[model samples]
Target: MANLKELRGRINSVKSTRKITQAMKMVAAAKLRRAQSQAEAARPYAERMARMLASLGQAVAGNPDAPKLLVGTGSDQVHLLVVVTADRGLAGPFNTNVGRHARNHIRKLEAAGKTVKILTVGRKGATYLKREFASRMAGEITFQGKKRVGFEDANAIAERLTGMLEAGEFDVCTLIYNRFRSVIAQIPSDQQLIPAELPEAAAETASGEAQAWYEYEPDEATILAQLLPKNLAIQIYRAILESAAGEHGARMNAMDNATRNAGDMINKLTLTYNRTRQANITRELIEIISGAEAL
Candidate 1:
């Protein structure tokens, strides 16, 4: 039973909040367009690169001297999880989803007697995971003020991962992030980076042949040595792009919902305020009439 002054104050506060949410929704929508396009464009290239590497690495996959990036350090004792999330919040569960997914993965790995290490790519993720997995955190990277994230950003991360692999820091590496699907849907996904996950070989070629024959110019080993690292960077870039788009989409959707909720609240409050004011006026009128009759 708030008085008129209190009701007015509450209404004004909600109105201000509604304005902010509306502005944020529009801003997120504008950003989502560019981010979504970039994410969609990177998918094909990344998929093709992965397929090519899978085909090329088939011969050397079982060899003892194969590139470590392709075959790993021959141990699954140590696992590295590279979790990608947004540097900022107010995007609903965009960052939380990835953090939770990574946490569950770490728990699963630990249950199986594996040592888990975390490499967070965003501030929100680091903060969320630091609560429980602080001891397991290997490193964190954030791009808070950066206007855009490009391949160079992904390359730097890839290089760091390569250095760690060479130093025998971790045997298996997996990336966790949100995959952009639509304006309102984002799927949390995990991809293996180190010791590349090879797709199954196709039984028939597009030309209707049982197998496709191709010859490498410098031989398979020579090509793989150079291609494996590039493939790693490309995969990371793709994941980053996907995460960027998903973040924007989630933010836009969240802001839109917030704005709508705010509007509904404002309407309810305004109705209540009017009713209260009317009630007060009626009470004052009745009091005045009672005084007149007494006089």
Candidate 2:
């Protein structure tokens, strides 16, 4: 049993920890609001862009002159996995969950005799993956110094990826990140960007309809050439936004749990201290009574 001084010290330590956790929880909550709003705002635009791309892709499905981004290299031998995670930690399993998902994908690809390469977007993801997939990591990008994620960040990453693709570094590219669905629910998602995977709506149109009412300004091939690259950048930007929101939500929940656990521990320690002190006082009172009776 710890003495009063030691118990008191422990209680004080726990109280201090509780204060920190509480503060972190509040901070996470504030950040989550902004991040969530940004994520929500980006979703519709990304979806609409995807739909438009899909429709356009359907129109030019069999065109020999189609952009290479729409009709990819005729092989899936090399794969690039772009994993997006948080640059910082203390967000519970936000980073771990994404890393695990990416790792599984990498393993699956390897088992199929396909070459796998990784492009990590955050420090945490890079560190987590380095333990097992270090050799497979092609590159890493960290936004540690950036106060806010912007289009420039996505554009730079896109330029690097497209440059690598044009250089024949990989045949297919997939992006993995956590998608923010709600404050408590973040879903890890994988999307194929390179050799773009046409959505179901576009796929349907490609197989069933022959439309003669389509018009293009510079020509379908030229428009697709521009749109395909823009789509990649936009998708990356959306993924970053989603990851930002999910990270805050995960951190907020983790901090709340820590705060509650700290409170419980404090209560338990206080009870123990009170009981011990009461027992000590009873022992002293009994000794005094015995001495008086004997006298």
Best by lDDT: 1
Prediction 2 TM-score vs. true: 0.94
The residue-level lDDT of candidate 1 at 64 comes to 98
* Candidate 1 residue 152 C-alpha distance from true site, Å: 0.9
Give me the runs in candidate 2 sitting further than 4 Å from their true place: 202-212
Q: Write the per-residue lDDT of candidate 1 for residues 141-215, one digit (tens) a residue.
A: 998899999999999999999999999999999999998878899999999998998776663255365544669
For model 1, what is the C-alpha lDDT against the true structure?
0.91
- Runs in model 1 deviating more than 4 A are 203-210
Clashes of 2: 0
lDDT of 1 at 196: 90
Worst 10 residues of 2 by lDDT: 203-212
Top TM-score hit: 1
Return the clash pairs for model 1, or none. none
241: Cα error in model 1, Å: 0.5
User: What is the C-alpha lDDT profile of model 2 across 1-295, one tens digit per residue?
Assistant: 7899999999999999999989999999999999888878877878888777767888887877666677777789999999999999998889999999998999899999999999999999999999999888999999999889988899899999889988999999999999888878888889998888888764546767654456889887788888888889999999999899999999999999999999999999999999999999999999999999999
lDDT of 2 at 204: 47
